[model samples]
Target: MKLLSVNVSKPKTIAYDGKSVTSGIFKESVAGRVMVRKLNLEGDGQADLTVHGGVDKAVYVYDLASYHYWERELGRADLAYGQFGENLTVEGLPDDQVHIGDVFRIGEALLEVSQPRVPCFKLEIKMEMPGFSRQFLASGRLGFYFRVLEEGMVGAGDTIERVKPGPEQMSVRETAHLLYFDYDNLDRLHRALRIPALSQGWRDAFAELIGTSEGAPKKPRAAARAWQGFRTFVVDKKVPESRDITSFYIIPEDRVPLPVYLPGQYLTFKLAIPGWPRPVIRTYSLSDGPCHEGYYRVTIKREPPPVDPSIASGSHYFHDQVEPGARLSVAAPRGDFYLDPAEETPVVLLSGGVGLTPMISMLNAIVHVGKTRPVWFVHGTRNGLHHAMCKHMRQLAAENDNVRVHICYSRPRPDDIKGLDYDSSGHVSVKLLKRLLPNREMDFFLCGPPPFMKSLFQDLRAWGVPEGRIRYELFGPASLLTEGTRIPLRKPKPASGAADFEVVFLKSGVTARWDPDYDNLLDFAEDQGIFPEFDCRSGICQTCMHELLEGEVDYVVEPLDPPYPGRVLLCCARPRTDLVIDV
Candidate 1:
């Protein structure tokens, strides 16, 4: 192994997207010997210390082979040794071959591989290619970052020798691929987590992957459902909770004792309207506690007119068409966001507008346990008129000394008295939370509109709340979130214990087994090396929709907004039979 060039550069400001941007991704080859410091190379500095220039990422190393490949791939002859902003450009260390935690001796400096280099927008600017960062990461040519073990000075043409290899069986590309692409490999995640030299950020990311499994004991799979695929639910009563929100009490026709579900879980309903050819499915949060008084309750707000009026709103169908004693096919309660009623820690149920549905359930369940775990039920709406179940929430707080409810009205009505109707006249924010709550020891559970969810999430993070303590149920993709970035989750495995199936990707020409371990076709397809574009894997988005050429499939998650005609939302679908799909 040999060093072709040692590059160094300081942070520089540049204009991008009509704003000033600063980055240190522009390095120039240094002529002579350079000092390798604990945090960075001499004369090299990063603009951001939060994500860059840490002791673990002191040096960035890129292989010459990747540069050569990119030169041919981009049809550009202007590629340079330090084009990737690497402090070390070497010939022998391939991204796929170098294992994270591997120690190497280069000249007088000793270093160990910490983690794979994730390309930021700065890389796209450096390459003068838009969307190149995604392409670079997906290509698995992302070079690795290094932790300087011993700082020393050496220059170009220095021989590199391996001191020790990473004990884990994952390369730089493998670790990145495990995180970004092949994320479902729990075995690999655990393996990567075992490496002590792995960066703390990567370690935390891996820990979050298994967070749910490591938390409170979950109900067994067999005990979770009271009935199979879809059960007949008869609406015993439908009452308006507020001017805009209504609650429906549903019970099985046979009057079976419904299984007690975790609080904050949602119920999926399949509506077979007279005019519709197929069942229209929608998911709504359970508003009542998990005591299951022979019935399950769902609170819903009537949806306003959608941009496309051709498609009827599911909530509208529930409010206008569905009546008392109406029969509906409802799936059993499910969702990872649900909270076990037995938790002893301080819990915060935060919500905005109609988002209070799940919070109501959570609050009711905690009160049912009568545990003095310090519960805070905080909610916000436009006014008392817009707030649903205000009396019910207040009653719960009044009844339980451990529970405290704080109401916020962004724009309160004239009749809305501060003491009676609301406690605050502003939005529910971290500022209000800090004043209302005792401390940061509480675990926050938030469900709200995008803006409300995003702001509060970012605020809590900025206030030093741990990521695991701030839980949320987002209607859209978490990727669109600016701060407190969270990874979207899917069922770890297919809920069905049915036999394995086959799925064919027509465009990719790959016919592969639909492993029983895969929750949906998207993960199965990805395992087969057919990665289709996707967002909001919960089926809210149609990004993963594709044409189903042949065979039938069942939706593991029914998209409230259905995909166009024959196209299937691969993220939430599982093949019922041998299937062929146009990628």
Candidate 2:
């Protein structure tokens, strides 16, 4: 295969569909040679490092030949090299020919084929075509990803010569087929797993398949072991954090040691209220450090619906109805939004309102772990009455000279003293941040309301903070960290000719017509008087997961973590075809 063009671009945030997303997909064809590095091209960068641009997926390559296929398929001649967001647009290489572990020399650099490129929603934005990602995957034209073996300069017209073939000799086509279609073939999967250069993600999937075939592993990270429906827990203590916020310390009835959860992880509680017909499942961040054994602390803000009294009744129930000694059904802690214990960089913890719950957990962890990394705890609330954990935070800061606290009350009371009770009196704006922050280079962790998060995200970007350095936790629906701007809604495609198509709850013995108004099957099921077990309706907890006995479903919003094969998270999925779910 011959390199036709070398494309590179720094990620740029764009306003699309009503969200702000940083995408590095708009690669431009460079005129001259570009230096390829271990992580990425010298001129290129990934928007999110968690999923993209690692040692396993340093460079993305697409076949220029496929552009011809897409040109004919789309009936458009506007297609160009690097349009598929590929760093290296080659002439001859296709998805079928490349193998995982195959090493090739292009220009002065040596690259190893690692894995198939998994398409995300960014493809739809780049192509300006709704549902383009599904089409791209279905087309089987997924380009291969490469890891840089040697850093060197590469340019257009460079010839790619294979220096070594893969150990398994499994073609990229076969791997994709095994992954998506022929996943049941244990023999083929075993062979594919032998490839040393195969990506961790793909390797994990293969291991899962092998494990499933030969009795699934007893302890898989994807599966919850301690969770069995929801066990009863006693609210041991109720301590008021603020006037409106309270901390509930809950202990298991068995009084066993609780599972160790990372700092910033949350516990999902299933609350059975007096008035509500169905039990409410709401997630609250574990406020206290894990060092405190036998019990978990959740700081909850008594949220009252301002415009309508119908919302957040769970918070209302927790504040008014629930008290010490109350039996509450609680699920095991689960969340991806956690402070990395391994991260050694200077930390900046920012919060607004009751968002300080997870930050306090992280801070306590930093102290407990004996980490001396410089920490800045900055918080914003209305006043002393609204602020929670003030004494605890101050005491922690006093104990650790490395930890600095800055509290900003948006509306301070007459009794609140400056530099004593509070540091400042204003909203947590960028101006205040600039003054308080020693530097803009620390690892920033932010949590708060939509408006607060939106402003801070934009401000951080403006301050040239790398997206990878900024981590955040959203309270609900994964909508707080808006990924992209809202594009015009596309017209719904006509339904296939099957008027009887409807979701069938196999065990529930209920069938319901699919409604577009309901964002997911969980909502639709609730509307049908069938409340399937659920927590973190955002799809993080995987509690609502059930067997997809038959038919197909599509995710309106993709889960934070993918569920195991044949299982669907009802919270985020909707019936695409008539679905038979073991609920």
What Cα-based lDDT does every candidate model obtain? 0.80, 0.80
CA RMSD of all predictions:
26.2, 23.2
Give a tens-digit lDDT track for model 2, residues 280-356.
66789999765334578999998865465543467878899888888898877766567743357999899999999
Candidate 2 clashes between residue pairs 3 or more apart in a chain or in different chains: 16-485, 16-486, 17-485, 17-486, 17-487, 18-485, 18-486, 19-484, 19-485
lDDT of 1 by residue, 414-460 (tens): 99999999998989999998898879887999999989988888788
Residue 108, model 2: Cα distance from true site in angstroms: 72
* lDDT winner: 1
Clashes of 2: 9
Scored against the true structure, residue 138 in model 1 reaches a CA lDDT of 60
Best by TM-score: 1
